[model samples]
Target: MSQKGGKFTKEYEGKKTGRFTRNNEDRKNTRFTRSNEDRRSERFTKNNEDRKSERFTKNNEDRKSERFIKGHEGNEVNETRPVREDIVEGRNAVIETLKSDRTIEQIFVAKGNMEGSINKILGMAKDKGIVIKEVDRKKLDFLSETGAHQGVVAMITPFKYSSVEDILGLASEREEAPFIIILDELEDPHNLGSIIRTAELCGVHGVIIPKRRNVGVTSTVYKSSAGAVEHMKIAKVTNINIIIDKLKEQGVWVYGADIDGEEYCYNTNFGGPCALVIGSEGKGMSKLTKEKCDKLVKIPMVGKINSLNASVAGGIMMYEVLKSRIDKKMQ
Candidate 1:
């Protein structure tokens, strides 16, 4: 009986050991499977990160390329755009420019709108060997700065400025006393233009304006001058007071137009070599400039309004000077 019990115990012990070994093996296999899944998840995460990195790099490159293209296009547009001051519009202005010595780059006429004076412009342009182009009215409208193009626009060289010596030389060549107009910071382009037209008609030698605080020879001035700008010599000076002193030394009587003047404009003697100084529209003249004048003269006023438009007063004063010269010539 004792030997049979021993065999039973050894068999039971061996079976228990085998079952425990199998359970240990199952745990190992489960751990290995979980490790393998962890490795796969890590690889998937790395691949996703790489894809995200690639997308981010591509997006950056696309943005850079887009900016480059837009910048290139903007440069092209800027290069093709015309300068505003280089353009001259309107029929009379263009025709007068054509008749002048100014260099016309090209003349653009509105298509199917060439009729009365346009034919004359074509003839004049042909005579001068200028290039004429027919374009849509929209093109002219776009190029017109004065909004009164009248179907004709001329692209000309920038208005050339003359020196003070050149202006005096022109008077010498004409064998006339130096009849000059010196503006004191005139702001209005229309007023400047009208004054220039009147100056041309009155046989004035040249017009002088300061480099600062004055309207330049713009398209509006050109249109207002009725092409008279072409025939006029305009000088831009650094110091108008210095120029006034120099003119006084040269025996040129410097007259200032002011509301409060000792003498009327018609009574003033403008017969000699003279420079008529027209003040600004708002302020009559700078204190320093007024002090520099040889004489301050006023236009006669009987109307309720004591003040006159700068251009109107300037015109009246200019006519008075011209009348003085004519009267002197007759005497």
Candidate 2:
């Protein structure tokens, strides 16, 4: 097009006519996008390295921890497994244990059941400064696996087992001598509780059992002992036979309770320091256990059962031992 003052004219409008027209803004946008992409790429690389470092740290820590635990397996470190439900129920059977063991956490009493004879138990608790809580029936039901709690349950740490060597040291310190019960897998906690109670009553030193096969203290055992397990010195060993051998070394006469043995408990001399071995209910003493006993004697059965509950058998034997000691003292 021709204008009045122009010989030739090319009409160029705004700075936007295709790629070069928007070049400045587009370059700005491109630079912005490139900056953002660069930031994102840097962020991704940083995150990847962080994750890798975290995994490496965790793996090495796990391996080191495994090695530390593995190295300590043979060493004597205090270890515990969860106490069995029956054992929890029976904790009350050993009342003295409630006082002696620092690990007794708490006692649960049924809402209205903490009265009367149970009141004395509360009194003991009060004296010992134990914490008591009144829980709902539902809570108690959930806690006590053995339905026989009869309104009382104790939360106890695993029974603190002292060593046979520790008891031997106790025996060695005392001029009066040691009186111990060497149980050959007495399976019932009730019997154990009662015997422990009796041992405490009769002034026996401590009771021993094999680590495996024997009944650990249970809620029932604790209940049956009427709190006796708490007071009696008890040792749990890896091997019952090893304990027997140790007892014999320490001058403790080994006596096994059996029907076919030569002498009756009444006739046998309990004049010296002694270890009484009682067997399980169905299988009395294992053959190996029986073979280790210096003497195998039976408690005479007047009743037709021909066998006694381990606790009863043990109680009888404990009293006999006590009586023998008394008789010897009199002489």
* Alpha-carbon RMSD, each predicted model: 10.0, 12.5
lDDT of 2: 0.74
State each candidate's clash count: 0, 19
- For model 2, the run of ten residues with the poorest summed lDDT: 72-81
Query: In candidate 1, what are the lDDT values of residues 42-159, reduced to their tens digit?
Result: 9999999999999999998898767544433343432344425677788888888888889999999989976899999999999889999999876776666566789999999999
Give the alpha-carbon lDDT of every model. 0.87, 0.74
For candidate 2, lDDT tens digit of each residue in 58-78? 998998766544433222211
Model 1 residue 268 CA deviation in Å: 1.1
